[model samples]
Target: MSVLEIKDLHVSVETDQGTKQILRGVDLIINEGEIHAIMGPNGSGKSTLAYTIAGHPKYHVDSGSILLDGAEVLTMTVDERARAGLFLAMQYPVEIPGVTVTNFLRTAKTAIDGEAPAIRTWIKDVRESMVKLRMDKSFAERNVNEGFSGGEKKRNEILQLELLKPKFAVLDETDSGLDVDALKIVSEGVNRAKENTGLGLLLITHYTRILRYIKPDFVHVFVDGRIAEQGGPELADRLEDEGYDRFLTETPVG
Candidate 1:
């Protein structure tokens, strides 16, 4: 079953200097219980694609359609998209100064699932997920992402993934700025979530290190705001061996 679909997606940002086109005629499809990796350089619009799919207000879809489970997601609001089982683990997680992680998780769970879990049951589940991510219990009491190291924030995102159990997840550079140990823990959490919930994943990243831990069913090379090439895991290996120079030279920007 196709869990998520993007057809000819074109996104642009309104700025002081007119609208800047980011994603240009991009198309992607992710099936249920599969892992799809979007690999590209820094400014290739990988994150833009993630945000556009997640219904980020800043990114206006000038043209195209996003469908989740056959529903038109481009017409939905951000929270509506999230409630429809689409989760985006942002590359740079925002810090909520006064909100504890526990409070944030509970509110989000209530909003997404339509009811909060029982207090004791929810805490227990959160603690277990933290343990699986090798996170300390104190993290639940702290403000969300405030004063947390890069790895800690990433792990916290995984914690939410476990708690929410979304049908589809877009991990935008979740492995960025992490050390080896932290990377393994985050990847393990993702693996466990997929195993336990059968969540489809669209992992966007520049480095191939994370792919070493979490094998992808399909790997796509994004260049010039569109998919330059796509193949099985071997595509990732080829990109690892030979840099993105070929993609850059061949794929023209629209």
Candidate 2:
């Protein structure tokens, strides 16, 4: 089975004031087909972990390793990491002004697969995935995320997720800005991707609402740049009832 491992990962970023540390000694292993939920308060290093795994240049890895199937992911470039079957669905997806959704998706697919996909097959796959995500056919001709609503942008992210079929995906606050209907649709799309590809997931969120739709096999509570507690799905239920007050009161461990 494919596995993604994070070992003693310590990360920092440069701010105007000085270098600010984010993730500290975060160690977790996600085997294929497992859904891991990361819940934490603001500034708890949840997004930092996501961006760090995706090799965002701003986040510096001071020490430790992120390994994918035993390969060092920290050593790979951003595109190289994507080609290696690592995917990150950003909390705020950026707009690609000049690139049509069609061209962008095809180009990304070609890069990841090392060859252009057969035209008819590629078109059909894109259409089907888009339909599943409730995206309109006209969206194919529009520039990526340009003039799109928040829900549209998120659907576009899951569109890439389904079509790209990565080994693992880090969805950083995907439910943000989504309404009840949009949330359900996006969650279903995510579930379909997991079922189709058996991709492992690192789902990060502040609220547990998304967890109701996309159940996690493991729930990890992030506090002070590291995991404060971890448990099964029951933990998420408990979190919903009782806030992060319990975790926040405890002193952080190095």
lDDT of 1: 0.92
Segments of candidate 2 deviating more than 4 angstroms: none
What tens-digit string does per-residue lDDT give for candidate 2 at 1-254? Answer: 99999999999999999999988899999999999999988999999999999999999999999999999999999999999999999999999999999999999999999999999999999999999888999999999999999999999999999999999999999999999999999999999999999999999999999999999999999998999999999999898999899889997653
Clashing pairs in 1: none
lDDT of 2: 0.95
**Model 1: CA > 4 A from native:** 252-254
Compared with the true structure, model 1 gives a TM-score of 0.97
Stretch of 10 with least lDDT, candidate 1: 245-254
Top-lDDT candidate index: 2
Query: What's the CA RMSD for each of the models?
Result: 1.4, 0.9
lDDT of each: 0.92, 0.95
Please give, for residues 103-164, the per-residue lDDT of candidate 1 as tens digits.
99999999998987899998889989998899999998999999999999999999999999
- Each candidate: how many clashes? 0, 0
